[model samples]
Target: MVPQLYCDFLQPDTTARHTFTVKPTELAYINEHLHHLNHHISNLIELRSALLHRSNQLTSPTYIVPHEVLSHIFNQANQMEWRSPQQAIVLSAVSRQWRQVALGTSKLWERVICQGPLKLYRDSSLLIQHCASYASSLDIRLLEQGYKLGAADKTFDTTTTVLSSSDVKGKLKALELQRIPSPQWIHMLPSFLRLESLSIISGHHPSVDLSSLPLSHVYLNGSTFDSLILPPSVLVLHLDDYFLDYAVILLRKCPRLIEFSSETYILTRAQLPPNLSNPLALNSLEKLVWYPAQWFMELASATGLNIPVINNLELKDSEGLKPAPFALLCHQISASLESLTLTYFSANDDWSIADLRHLFTFPIPTLRKLSLTDWSHRLILNAICALTPDEGEDGYTDRCLPKLEYLSISSQDEIFGLEFDFDYRVLNLVKRRRIGEDSPFHLDFSFCSDDDADYEAQAAWQPELLHELKEFVANRPVTITIKGGEVELDQLSTARFDDGDCSS
Candidate 1:
């Protein structure tokens, strides 16, 4: 649409005019043309809006990424060490595409952990419902962080109702409760059909029965021996303070138990039934552990149960204890045992050091691994050195462990009352072990001292010994490791090797 003045003055034969008179007819014509241009501008704006919407859809990375790859990305993001469920919630809220991918992936919503108070049970229930249908197995943990154990005002009924409801029951596979006040309502813990592992960590005994659950692993951190009534389906049981009789009852009931561990209390020898004379055979038991080194002596004397096929044994204590009973224990189970660990928790007068040397009295041919933690001394080092083949006119006779392969000794205690060295005696043992052929033995030795120079001397032993041992065997199979800390060792014990220092 041309302006009226241009149309009138700029004809082919007409002269150009700079001024024109205003007329009502030309004014209406100009208004009509302006309305048409306004419509064209509006149409161009609508076209741009439509085209940008199409461009966003075409350029979005979500459209480029295949659904299979996006699902894996969501799973990887959720696989990080999640301290709380809020982390997963934050990932889902990143964008609409992220929320869709997170919801579609079942593994992302499989585990839900809620800490602090029963009030969060409702929140957890909602989360469980959201993930219930797709998740094949659900793991939930409700922790009462600040509540006092056995407090009268605390109630876990709300938590029980939410967990026991139909929405969250059959799908629960793992549940961990930390510091819940009263778990008496946990009798229904067995009703979760697919539940595999349950851990209740508190300071009070809730008198809850777990005998109906087919749980593979159960850890009752604070329950007493009398209150524990385990089911037959339990494959592993770890208790805090258990009695001799309760241990017996548990062994008799759970024949499928693979491992049993506890912090045992010392009880009387008379607790054993007078009519029972023979040792009960624990055919399926593989590992037995007792803390407070004296408990091993007390229980061995009290209950004469024989673990015919046990593989691993560990004992820890602080008080000075005799090794005779421990030797007898090794004699009973030495045929099938593979690993033994003896730990002393104190650094007093080295009274337990003498007892540690007596452990080699009973020969364990099948013993493969031995750990002596916080009990490292000159006497114990002699025991290990004694394993070197005694090259006489006849062959070696005092070979204590024929098949032994691994030995670990760590000394983290202060050296005020204890003293030892990282000198030639230990170095010679490795050289002698490699005299005939490649020996399969490996020693892990760590010492703590105040001298950094001592560490340099100690650390040099490994590479020096390795260089010499490889002279015979093309590839030396023996490994000797040495490290040092803040404890002091004068390294003067080599001169006393001829003093007949075997402390029997």
Candidate 2:
């Protein structure tokens, strides 16, 4: 129809030799019709484009997916650290259907990570407000600005504006503040009434008090506080590079704490309060992880601090393990400790085999599971010797950890080393333990090596050892597993012993 109307305007010029004169009013009339024709053509082109887009969307596989499934995918993507806020924004811009799903998924907006110059705090606050409107709970992270330029007055003002907002204070459930520059920011923490988990890393302040809030988990790393207080509602507490004296003070206040972990806590025994002489009891504590500092060893070994019923204990020391203190500490908790893991990364000469033997000599009758990681093969052998039953005048008797049923030994550098004696001893211990027990016994060994020569050396002896182990446990109530080096036993049958297992 448009082409036909345009052809009508050209009809008067069809004769080639005809001379014609047009009046200004007649020319104006022709110009008006041509302008209208161009406008209608543009409208028809836009309509065609719209229809094509809609057709593509209807046939696309992504558009066919249910909104609930897409929303869940968006939520999972939002959980990733790298994807986070950018991923959520990108998802909302992909298409109409995706934007609707992304906006409706509240979890995608729950985590708001704010990190930039002080000038952006207002923007971050606005983002928090917008997110709070859609999410009932918020996990906010205020990361360090990385530059201290012009941060003195502006830091406090901007941080307060962002953190003290009614939406932030009311909706925040988890808060992580990293390298907070000003002490005033610490004072604003108590205003977050709905906060349950808080992590403050790498800052120095005179004091910190969270007793007013109903916190269930708190993590403090590379931070110093003169006076620290925790509420009894705290269930998990982790302190790294903090003062041991302060940790002791905080532990005394948290009676309901179920899990406590301390790593590299500065030891200042002289600064300890006089009342610390009284036995500190954590009756409800279930798990204790201590990366032992010297003061931690002395405090636990010398003092009367008692954890009556700790079920899981993990002690990892990279320097070296002191035998006397470790033995005493184990004996103190031996009654109720059900699982024990010992990890050390010291040079072979720094610790002696006798030390390892002495540490395990204490009878932890209640301990059913034991794991030793990154220890020298010699030390592991001594540990096995200590746990093995000693020959008495009458018969095999006086075995340490009489109720032990599970043992796992993992070494990243060292293997059994050109020696068959360790293999025989391990087999002997397994056979003796499984003899009169109706319950199944589990033994796992993992030896990994970065050096090709070392791995090959380990490979040479691993097969024979695995074969002997399989034969001993064949058709018996015993489970033996081996991994790392050149071993690949995972598929051979939960029963095959010809080759070792590889787990990497």
Whose lDDT is greatest here? 2
Candidate 1, superposed: residue stretches over 4 Å from native: 1-91, 95-101, 116-122, 144-158, 241-249, 264-280, 318-320, 345-358, 376-379, 385-398, 416-419, 450-474, 482-504
Q: Deviation in angstroms for 47 in model 2?
A: 31
lDDT tens digits, residues 1-504, model 2? 112222222234323453447677566766776776677777677767666656655654345866445444544343344445644433545767555544655665677777655455434555666677777788887776622423456545654676677877888999988887667777888788888999988867777678899999999899777777778899999988866667778888898889999887454332454566678778889998887634557566445777888989887764544666667788888889999988864445344556665666577778888888766666666666656655541113545566777788755544344552555666666655553355677777654443454232332334566576667667767665564333343333232233233443
Candidate 1 on 371-488: residue-level lDDT in tens?
Answer: 7765545434545555444455122344556566787665543342323544444556555554334356566665443234332112223445445444534465654433212221
TM-score list, all predictions: 0.66, 0.71
Weakest 10 consecutive residues, lDDT, candidate 2?
A: 1-10
Relative to the true structure, how large is the alpha-carbon lDDT of every model?
Answer: 0.57, 0.66
